[model samples]
Target: MGRLATLAALHGVATVHSPGPDVAVPVPDETVVAVLAALGVDASTDEAVQDALTRAESAAASRLLPPTVVVWTTPDPGTSGAVLPPALPRALADLPPGTGLRVETERGDTVEWPSLDAPPTDAAAPGPVSAAPEGRSWPDLPLGVHRLAAVAADGRTAGAVLVVAPREVPQPPPRTHGFLVQLYSLLSTRSWGMGDLGDLAELATWSGRELGAGFVQINPLHAAVPGDPTDPSPYRPSSRRFPDPVHLRVEAVPEYAYVTGQGIALLDGLLERAAGLRAAVLDKGALIDRDAVWQLKREALEIVREVPLGPGRRAAYHHFLAEQGQALEDHATWCALAEVHGSEWRAWPSGLRDPRSAETGRARHELIDRVDFHSWLAWLTDEQLAAAGRAARDAGMAVGIVHDLAVGVHPDGADAWAQRDAFAEGMSVGAPPDAFNANGQDWGLPPWRPDVLAASGFAPYRGLLRGLLTHAGALRIDHVMGLFRLWWVPAGADPTRGTYVRYDAEAMLAVLVLEAYRAGAVVIGEDLGTVEPGVREELHRRGVLGTSVLWFERDWEGTGRPLAPESWREDCVATATTHDLPSTAARLTGEHVELRHRLGLLGRPLAEEQREESAEVADWLGTLTRLGLLPADGGDEEEQIRAVYRFLLRTPARMVGVWLPDAVGDRRPQNLPGTWDQYPNWRLPVADAEGRPMTLEELAASPRLHGLMSVLRPSVVN
Candidate 1:
């Protein structure tokens, strides 16, 4: 089909092309179809032409949709730029009345000012700009503090203004200190081979009271996608909204003790297995067996559910049900669907694919009881998490418990199934090419569509924050830059082909601050990697703390030496290492590189890279020695750890995180990225440098661990 004819046909427009006329006349679809029949072309049989036209029209329409508005505010004459307030609302509304706006361009220093009313045709098309309403004062405006303004009719201020500032909502107070820890499935005594809520509470209480730790930051406890052998990594979760019930301490339930005759006997073996699992980790130094623990607990919980919930407990359950309501239903529906549809909803029956379809509705009703059970599990998990937080508070921890928010949820999981509209289909969230991973990594998680998110007022994001912040004194946002933009790898494309899609950072941050402020929780952004310039500045401006990892700290512009503690950014939570990284002992001893090479997963040969990397580390150690920070030779591991903390103490960072593994001199990292089955990702227990398991009790008394804390005690203690 001809271009004009195809475009017209696709758009449902009729086109008339006369031999004598150069111009083609466009007519409506009805008219064209009737005329085509009269001409005997049988346009109804022209499906190819019709499809082409449809696509062409769609492309054209997309181009015509409103462009994003980019407002630029001129700096006050003498100043380089306006020193906007931390907040933006108040300043945007106070522009003087009857202000005339103009766009300026420079042609070799001769400035050309284009009229706002009659914008240049060749110039960038003018986007829709809403003028300031009459009689609104800048201070009284709801835009907060920092806002853009221009000179008006009296040369004071006029034209469009862009507001760049912190959210109006109050920010959560900083977490003064924290002891970062990870719970292994095999470590807790009461767990069915998995660390349970009871253990979490116990650990929090002990760490808070005896160790004088202000906060306890745990790994992500998000529910995993259910399967025979579930994915062990907590970072890859099914749902960020709900906690996994597998972490529940079965014996801790009030009704467990009240089980009748046969039930009690049946539960005995499960209880024994639970105790044995805990012993294995605490005594035997074995890695946590998550699948085995789940098997034991699932059996135990099935029996426990038979012991009827008492009236008061049932009422409390109902209250939780009420609080969770739709979200619970959706999550449970997702779980049930996964069981029937096999995880990925895309491969499911056509009728059952859309979550809102009648097939899904009927299935939801049919599986109502199953859904209730899942919801109950979530409630139990929440109760335990709250109890852990309370234990920290009761034990007198300053900042109490801090929770980790994973970067994203699994694509075929609850959040994706529940809020599909908010997520971008056929796109995966990933990282761009970086020094560590030459080939960028695709996380296989769907990203939130910026347009959809803003239109919904970020309700899904807000809800998640509120839920997580409920029992947390501080929240660590994994890959916090996701709030601003996400790297979107289109389906079937490599990570390199991915582009950065922008998000309403201001809106997202505002919502986050609002929820965190109300929950009285501090926010920490894991702003690591190839961050866009000014993102950290924006986060700092918003009272959000940045993450400072010791290994990554460097003099970016100078000779590449490890950044000095005094020169480190103050607006951050400084840490020796994270869950995904090598533990301090492992790094100091060079075990991590060796482990990678042994698995045949190292990008380069182990010995060669080790030599180069070790030399850098040796140089860093020399620098530390020169600065009087490193201890003299022949010191034990404990002394070495103390030296590391002493260096961290020198930084002006508001908070310092003492990794639990580091305290115990654990030689292995809890997780090693880029290697899945080759190594256990999240199943390792807290062990000593020699791979000897350490119980909470032993950890408390270990002089090596204790000495390290002693160094940090004065710096973190209130």
Candidate 2:
């Protein structure tokens, strides 16, 4: 076995070696190491072993359990119900020795402290309950969120008051709503190889005013690690706390007009190239060239950095620096380091790889200029995002822009490297084996250690949320269940060997709610898999919206039937599809399954199942016809699209999402899962159902597209 594996096995056993109340002391090192390794720790090294022991100790110390007993006074069991003064403290303190005490009451309840030995019967005669003790009033829980009902002393009746422990609540931002769109699928005439922010603004203006969309929800715009065939999945971001500047509309940069001084020629050329690139995507209907865009932007930014910040701009820059502080510094530092060390920090020089070592500090000072450039890029990206949100609002979007929060960042990237102490080393976040993916999938993103996060008051998580939510009217959290618990795949183990690690859902939720409340943003959880029981209920109670996708909306527990529109959950944002899956047209026509088959992604041969599935869909269409939901033959395609919207209108969902591509009959999905090379994944342009490229103008004028909009107008207005 490798040295690290050997050490990890030893550490695992040693860490779990706690002598039970009746067992012997000093468990074997081998046993402990085995247990520690199972938890994804390499305990071979002395340091690793020590770390495991410390973690175990910390977990034990922080473990919370329900109170042993809860007691309160009320009318005598058999007598006429009468108002009574209860001896609250005595009843709590007099519990059997070793029993934990929890005393709860309604607002304005009194606690008269006699001795701990005093009985409730010894208190004064029944009277109105005294005012609540000073500094003891229950904290104001989130309004409009659900709370679990408290049980009274009789066990047969509900308590008069409800006290909820702080938890994450997904509350909609105050009086705001907007349309949601997939950015790449909303191609414009001006886009280089794909859609840009300029197109986004126009779409927002049109949708907000014409369609009355409250918000414009978009996929995650998180920075991707720079490389060839750059990771197309936005969910695997280099850093969740920073936006990718590649999304910036080059012409939108203020500095673009001021290029004339030293290094100005270089920037001018790059800008010209960027403009050409945009022209190609918009004019020719080509695939998005992310690497090309990044190359051009990087060169332009290099020159822009040379232009000294004007006094006023300098002040703004300083303000941004102050706001970002260490987080920005760390992210920029990681970027600089990546230039020299590549994406995997572990492969770098030992001294430089350790984020806290003196060697890294020296490297930071040496690469100070590069770091500043990266920081500037982040600041500019932030400004544009805020501008987009403002534009949406100015155009009368009620909810403005809703941004997506990726579930995690790349393990070897900025956030993980910068916040190593906060993450569980050698462990990766993933899903447990399920029907969809029997082998399970490891995300290769490190997970936060619950104890460590709690100890630090969730500062890292809070900072990330604050950055994403700063200008967002609403935020969608990918894989929201991770807030409660995450399946941890230990490094070097098959995904099946991994186990679920619990988190303090209350604390995590509290932090999320607090941040969202501060940012005036609503929260939505992408809860779409093998969710534990009560998770959806808890999310609904917290006012956090859940995601209800058209394809998966089925009554799995009963006779398996696609969920009726009216039966959809009200506390959710209903959408036709998402970035990770095939678009609506593709699903309806079986293009996705065909593509998967072509890519050899099917577990079974496609020939056998494809025919059967196709027939099933035909039958489904027949049902739609029976329900009067199908369009008449020979009408506009938009008429058929309108039928789809009419179905959504039947649902009671508070918010509805319109995939940008669907509005224009774009056949290609923004992404295609399980294919890294055969498909462009995130690079496809918005195209029509016939696979014809459509520019922004053509999209606007398309009869099929406009017809769909006509159908949605009445429902949105109502």
Candidate 3:
């Protein structure tokens, strides 16, 4: 057991800390063994454990540095463009004197110290580190990823990727308020069954110009895994690298006007069908059918693809293809193959499962045309996303469009199949047992292997950030704590048996900050829920804004009372509700409890659940009444909703987000966490208090919405 423990520690696998503090229950030996196996270490038996431990220690001794080294440049004060000399990083400092070194900087410069006399000081910089130097003080190497080669005294040599980044991410210009919404739930009259990029553009334009919004934060639009019944949750997507084509507005395509003969007839037919599909959800109360909508759009797109691109358009397409490179090819190939085999790539033939295998290469040649079609879809989505961002900025938005980045990718999706080496096999990402659920949770998404990530200098992760930030003003990371650690559950095992696995948070943050920096984008960390104590502080120090939902912002350590607006953290986005929770109306009227009870999702007696929920609401209402945001009479139900936004304004938070559904007195949550088909998880359109879906035009003209927006002044202290 001791030998196994040492082996696990060397691999950064947690054998404890699941189910949390004060609990003496240790992680099972089997769980530790399974996690080790996933990391390519074998500790199945006592003899195996000792053997693995010996090999691990031997590797540690021989290794000069981790696969990656990150450094933050320290600028000297009271000097003209001067930087302090960097002290020896712990990794370099530990080596014997007279070691040889070579550095190839990003700016095509080189620095070599043959039989080093001195290039490093004895002191090291303090920050998130993996044997990082005490203080980053390299005057010669500018900010970028560089290469380093080291030769030890005894003739051993090692090479590592060196990263130089800024100390913090870009900060918001000033305090600003924005609308938070799930893009698909917001439908305009022109949309075909679900919201499209066109709808997003109009929403941003209207909100930025008329409603005085500074940003429009929307749910992730990452490409979905295609199947008969595609998963509707945007959080679980096929590839975070590409936007989903389902959200594209067909008519917006320039080639739509160029279509002739049979193509024009087919498009018209699809358009009429699309109108019927949209009417079903808005006028007939039917849930949003993502698969059906995709089918119609896919058919229409096939016809549009026949039209030849203009000279200028052709050039732009080639530019996009060149920039996207191999990543686009892999994603498109997966999509084309999925059309033949299925969405789940693991179920495909063994030869085809390996993306780089010779068989897969042969298959790619045969499916060349289909692959090109899918690649075109990605390009179209990219074009619309850029248009949406431009619309927001043109309408005089301050922060413009804010895009969400989900924590992980679907287990059997494009990213997992294409980048299998970077992801753990037979291990799924999840949460340890907490107050919410004793059994914990398995999200069914594969976690990126930290070993692979460091070895490659987090190249894949950096690429993902750049893609998302390309058209975003700000990027919000879902479950930002994941930058530090994630719970790993073995396949087919209970989530409760999972244990936490640590990542080099220093390297992760350096890559994130560097990429976002290059894009000139703000960063928001979704650090809600029971967070590890120092995680939020570290993020804040890096200029990453945290998410502060109203319901969860309490003085937990003290009286457990609602945290006063004045007391709220300034470096956060404050809001009354989010997609995962009840709308303002539902909380005020206790309709959420009723909805859950009706769906048989209640875990307790009806009266007991209602009483607990009611008490919680009463406490918050009392706080609001005292703050003068709520009137003593509280006459109209919608007035209470308006009052909630007013309260959010009182907080000194730099960014304020109003959940778009709450603007119209919506009574239902866009998502109900625990329920799947029993409740429509992500299908409902934005609706009014009576549960009637409202179109974008109606919503814009809604009296309830206007009244809510009126309370959202630029800076309302009181």
- List, residue by residue over 562-583, the lDDT tens digit for candidate 3: 9998999999999988889999
If both were scored by TM-score, which would come out higher, candidate 1 or candidate 3? 3
* Model 2: per-residue Cα lDDT over 109-204, one tens digit each: 333322223221213233233322321112212221121222223332111112222234445533333455657656665554556677777777
Which candidate, 1 or 2, has the higher lDDT? 1
Greater lDDT among 2 and 3 belongs to: 3
- Model 2 TM-score relative to the real fold: 0.79
The stretch of ten residues in a row with the least summed lDDT in candidate 2 is 156-165
lDDT of every predicted structure (CA atoms) = 0.69, 0.67, 0.86
Best model per TM-score: 3
Best of the candidates, lDDT: 3
RMSD of 1: 12.7
Query: Candidate 3: minimum summed lDDT over ten consecutive residues — where?
Result: 122-131
Worst 10 residues of 1 by lDDT: 137-146
Against the true structure, candidate 1 has what lDDT? Answer: 0.69
